[model samples]
Target: MLKIEELQKRIDELLLKAGLPRHSVNLCTAPVGDGTPYISFENGKYNYIFSERGYEFFRKITESTDELLYWIMSELAYKIAFKYELENRIEGRDGRRIAFPKFIELMTKINPLWKLKAEDEIKKTLSASPYDDSLYL
Candidate 1:
C-alpha cells in the first residue's frame, strides 16, 4: 500500500518538477461519499481530494513506489493544467470540453521533461505490473 507521507512526498516532487510553488496545492484523502476525486482552487491554493475509492484503487494497482508516484504525478498534471487554464483564461473548444489533450500539449510545451519523465514512469509501472484484472471492478 502507498503511505500518505510517501504520497505527499511524491506530490511535492511533481510540483517541483512542474515549477509550481509548494504552497500552490494541498493534497488530502477522505471519505468523499461520491467515490469521485476532485480538485478545487480557493484562497490561492488548490485542494486535491482523493476519495476512499480512489485510494483503494491505487492500493490495488500500485505495487511499487514508482508506480504510486506515477499515479499521483499524472493526477497532479491534470489539476495543474486546469489551474493554468483558469488563471490564463484559456477556454476549451465548447466551453465544456475535457481539454485533457490540450492541457497535455500545453504542459509538454512548457516543460519537455514532464512528458518524457511521465512516459518513462508509466512504462516502468506497466511493465512491472504486467496485468490488472480488477480494472472492471
Candidate 2:
C-alpha cells in the first residue's frame, strides 16, 4: 500500500511545478472503473481519485522516492493536458498549447532516466500475460 502522506506531498510538488495552486489540489480515494485512477476538478479543487487496483498499480510503479515524484509529475502533466482540451484552452496561461507531445517532452526533460523507466514499467504492465483467460469471454 502507498502512503497517503507521501502521495500527497508528491501531488503538491507536481501542482507547484505546473504553476498551479497547491491548495486547489487534493488526494482522495474513490471508486473507479478498470482499476484506473482519474482526476476531477470541482469547486475550484482538483481531486485525484485512486481505486484499490489503481493504488496497487501506483505502489508497484513508485518503488522509490524519486520514482514516486516522477510518476506523480507525469500524471499531473497528463491531467493538465486533458483539462486544457476539455476547457478548450488550447493556449495555456503561458500562451502555449499543452498537448501530449509537450507533456512527454516536459517529462523527459524533468528526468529522462525516470521517464524511460516509467514507460518501461507501464509497457510491462500493459503487455499480455501468459495466463490469459479473458479472451474466451
Number of the top lDDT candidate: 2
The 10-residue segment with the lowest total lDDT in model 1: 90-99
Q: Give the TM-score of candidate 1.
A: 0.43
The lDDT values for all models are: 0.51, 0.53
lDDT of 2 by residue, 32-84 (tens): 55655544444434344455643534333333556545645776666665675
Model 1, 20: alpha-carbon shift in Å?
1.2
Instruction: Report the Cα lDDT for residue 64, model 1.
Output: 54
What shift in Å separates residue 57 of candidate 1 from its native position after superposition?
A: 9.7
Q: How well is each residue in 1-137 modelled by candidate 1, as lDDT tens digits? A: 44566567766766676676774444455556554554333443334455564353322233455544444556656676576556554232321123344455534543565567655544575577643434423
Model 1 residue runs over 4 Å out of place are: 29-60, 83-98, 105-137
Clashing pairs in 2: none
